[model samples]
Target: MPEIRPRSTIVVTLLCIAGLAVAGVALAYCVHLGAQRDDDTGQSAAEFTYIPPNQAGLAADDVTPESDEVPEQLDTVRSKIMLCTIDKIGTDVLSVHTPDGRKHQLTLSPDTHVESAKGNEVADLTTGDLVVVRVIESDTATTVDLIVDGRVSSSIPDN
Candidate 1:
């Protein structure tokens, strides 16, 4: 009986070690697959949001994507195109209200340009300023250009 006990313990320990090795290999393989998804490889699948077809009698061309804003995964902000009133301003952001009173906040990065009508610094812009802001829409204003009095006053990034 003592001999049988020792044999059983050896078998159990060997089985446990083999199982752990298999688990480690599976974990490494899963991480590799996840890395592939982030690459631009053809092996990656197309990412899309699900919606019923022809829900609003609109064609695919006219239909908006599930998300109209720039994806958060992007490090750069996008741009927008519209005329709106500067609703509010803070240290690093500005809120612009549309003609219909819909407000959107524009983000300012360290690279954002703040200029005046004659190529000077627009140090202060007020809440009532009428502006046409061309924007690339992320969660915040990624790329934004402020047009005042029918001229480009400020824009994000020189290019």
Candidate 2:
């Protein structure tokens, strides 16, 4: 039989309370982060809008060009961002299949940056990860930028 000391009981109670407080703080922080990520995802998804090929010219006509704009500079590059599913991941490339039924092998360089919700690196990317890739093409060379994990937004209508 162990003697029940009031001082020992108080210490144990305080420790339990402290543990609960820490757990509560951690839970709150996690919730806050989740909300923040949701907000970011919403904003990013809104940036992409689908336009049918037939309406491409009509959509372009709606925008007026600025006459004051200077000619294209040497550093000017064309870039496209696409949402795709990873079919395979390699040391310096990623094989992805797009919703358009096209498979592509995107080259990765030392400068390529990969991101995910878990703060993962390029090596952490696995097969079948939905990702958004930015491909930039210039007269001299083509390069890729950020490859970030993504989700299909409900706002986007299914084909």
Candidate 3:
């Protein structure tokens, strides 16, 4: 019913362009956040186990000459064993098999991590690769430290 105005049409077009720009920026930011979350998920898997520091023979330090001597508690040593490989290495954890034919899962600690030799040789390992690993026993759970220097031999059986 009213006459068409060129100035009003121009203003409306500019506002529509500004709204589209804002929406595009928001979508890009959301995608970046999702990628960051995926990267952090592998790091959190390291918390599965921890070893406590040695604290034996502390009470004996407070004893005086006149007082009765207190017996010091002996520290218990943990055993290290070879873990059998059951599957391929992942971003954070490795699947293994125990000597008793039971399945066990292990994780790589931040301090004790794995590296590939010969340009991504470790990454090429597939399921049924034979790998020797060292593990430490802790109160909370068992922690894997190092991978014994070797490659997956063909003699090992597949899971």
Q: Clashes in each model (backbone N, CA, C under 3 Å)?
A: 7, 0, 0
Flag regions of model 1 displaced more than 4 Å. Answer: 1-78, 139-159
Task: Summarize candidate 1's per-residue lDDT along 2-115 as a digit string, tens digits.
Answer: 435667888999999999999999999987776566556555454544444534566657757666544556475655577888777777777778899787777755555554
Model 3 agreement with the true structure over 9-35: per-residue lDDT tens digits:
899999999999999999999877765
Clashing pairs in 2: none
The list of candidate 3 runs beyond 4 A from truth reads 1-77, 113-125, 152-159
- Per-candidate TM-scores read 0.38, 0.46, 0.38
Error of 1 at 97 (Å): 0.2
- The lDDT leader among the candidates is 2
Candidate 1 structure lDDT = 0.64
Worst 10 residues of 3 by lDDT: 45-54
Q: Each candidate's lDDT (Cα)? A: 0.64, 0.76, 0.61
Q: Write candidate 2's Cα lDDT for 45-157 as tens digits.
A: 32655544444656444753465234455345799998899998888777898999899877777888877865658887778889999988777555668898885344656
Ranked candidates (lDDT, high to low)? 2, 1, 3
Cα misplacement distance, residue 94 of candidate 3 (Å): 1.8
Q: Name the better of 1 and 2 by lDDT.
A: 2
